[model samples]
Target: MPTRRRTLLLIAAALGLPRAGAAPEGGYRFQRGLMGTRFMVTCYHEEGELVGKAVAAAFAEADRINEAASDYIADSELLSIGKVPPGTPVRVSPLLFGLLEEAWAQAEKTGGLFDPTVGPLTRLWRESRRRKALPDAATLAKAKAAIGWKKLVLDPAESTATFTVPDMRLDLGGIAKGQAADRMLAILGKHGVPCSSVTAGGDVRMGDPPPGKEGWNIGVRNRDVDRNAAELVLRNKAVSTSGDLRQFIEIGGVRYSHIVDPATGLGLTRPVSATIIAVNAATSDALATACCIADRETGRKLAAAQGAEVFLAEG
Candidate 1:
C-alpha cells in the first residue's frame, strides 16, 4: 500500500445557545466524574422543596444507570454481559436495555460501520500504544475477527443480551454519551427547570439555552494542526467527529490512523474528517466514527442519507 495520509476526526462541543436569563436561584452543585469524564447537572425548580429531592433521585438513577452501562469497570453489567456465557439470560436494567436497543439501531443504520463491539480492537490498540510498538498485521487481524456487532443477540421482552460467538464482545463507549445526555435531560425536566444544559466531555445536551444565549456554538478543531480558531455552530443539536491523526503511528512514511475500519481491522490510511450534527449526542458520536472509518466520499453520502447534516475536511 502506498503511504496514504491518515485523516483525523476533529470534533467540537459547543453549548452557546441563548435564551431568557436564568432564574436567580441556588441549584445544587451536582457533580461526578467517571470514565475520565466529568458530569455536571445544574438546575432550578419552581418549588424549592422539590429541588433537593429531585436531584437526589436523579443522581441515584444516574449512578445506577452508569454502573449498568459503563465498560470501564470489570464488574459493570456491560462487561458482565460481554464476558458471561452466551444464552445464560443474565438480567439487565431497563436503562441498559434501552441503551442496547439504541446501539443496535445505530449499528443497523450505519450498516455495521458504527459497531459498539469494537472493544477488543480498541484494547489491542491500547496495548500497542502502551508498549510503543505497532502490532503486526496478523495480530491486528486476530483482534478484529473477535470484534463484531452482529454477533451479539438482544431479546427485548426478556431484556437479555447474549453473545452468539464465544469471542464476540461489545463496548458501550459510543452509546454512553447519548444515554447520559438523555438521562440528564430527564432529570432537568423532572426538576421543573424551564431550561438547562448538560455537558460531559464532548457530549452536550441543552434544555433551553443558557439565558439570552443563542444556540450552542460548537467548535471543530483543525486536526492537531490548528486550535480553537476553526469552529462550527449549530442549533438544538449535538455534533461529533472522529479523527485518525490525533494519536497515530507514522512509520516509514506511512501514517496509521487510530480510527480503525471495521471491514479491514486496520487503521485507515485515508485522513478524512467527518463532522455530524444530529438530534442526539450518541448518534453524533457513532456517525462521526462510522463516517471517518468509511472514509470521506462514501461516508459523507451515508451520513447525508441518515438526515444528519454533514461537514467534511477531506483528507
Candidate 2:
C-alpha cells in the first residue's frame, strides 16, 4: 500500500479552443485527498448545485473502488485474498476479479514488466529504502521466489482466485488509481455530468472538452526545468506517467527508483520517465509502469502495440 508518489506536475486549464456550448458563467472544481494522493474533479455547468452533486457522487464511487483495491487497508478485499492459504480458491468481488484478470493479461503481454505479484519485492524495496541500504541477496531471492503471475489461478465462472505459492501477494497500485479515475468518470456520466475531468495522482481521465474548448491541456512537469516538459491535449482520453525523479532512495551514492524491476527484485537505476496516453487511464497507468521496466525500444514498441502513444525521457 506504500506506493510511489506520482509526478503529475500540473493539469492545466483549457487552452485557446473555442467554447462550443453556451459558456457557463463559471466552472466548478473540487479537490479531495484520496488514495494517498490528491483527487480533483472539474466540471462545466451553469448550476453550482448540479456540479457539486455530480462531484460528490464521483468521489463516492472512487472511495468504493479504492477500498476494494487498496493493499494498505487490512480489511480490503485484496488483502483478504492475500491472507487465504495457498491454492485455496476464494470468491472475490467482480471488480477485484476483473482487475486480477487484467493484471494477469498485462503481465503476460509485457513479459512480466508489469506484475501484480511483485508485492513481496515491493515490500522488500520499501524496507531497503527505509533502512537506506539495499536488500541482501538472500532476502531478495526469497521475495522473488514468491512472485510470478503464472502462479496465480483464476476461475472466471466461479469468480474465485487462488495463489499457488504461500505468502504470494498482489499490489494494484500501478493501475488502481487509473481504474478509479475511469470509474469515477463513468459515475459522473451516470449523473448526467457530460463535460468533466478526474485526476487521481498522475493518472487523468477527461470527458468532453469544457464548453467550446478543443481539449484539456495537461502539462507534463519536468523536474529539471521546474516547468512543464510538454503539454498533452486530452478529450475522452487518459494519460499516465511513471518516474523515479520524485519518489526514490539514495544508498551508497546511487539512486534507486521506487519503480522496481520484478526480474531482479531491484529498483530501476536508469534516470528514465515514461508517459503513456491511451483510451483509458488504467491502460495508460499500467503500461507506463511497463515502460519503466522495459528497454527504450521495447517500451515504445509495447506502447505502440497497445495503440497508445509513449514519451520516454532518459537522463
What are the TM-scores, per candidate, against the unseen true structure? 0.78, 0.90
Residues 20-117, candidate 1, lDDT per residue (tens digit)? 12223333334556545766554544443354455555556667767887767778888887666665666788888888889988888889888888
Write the residue-wise lDDT of candidate 2 on 127-215 in tens digits.
Answer: 99888999888888889999998888899999998999977988888888988999889888888887998889889999988987999
Off by over 4 Å in 1: 1-32, 40-62, 224-235, 245-255
Residue 231 of model 1, lDDT score? 67
Positional deviation of 287 in candidate 1, in angstroms? 0.9
RMSD of each: 10.3, 7.8
Best model number under TM-score: 2
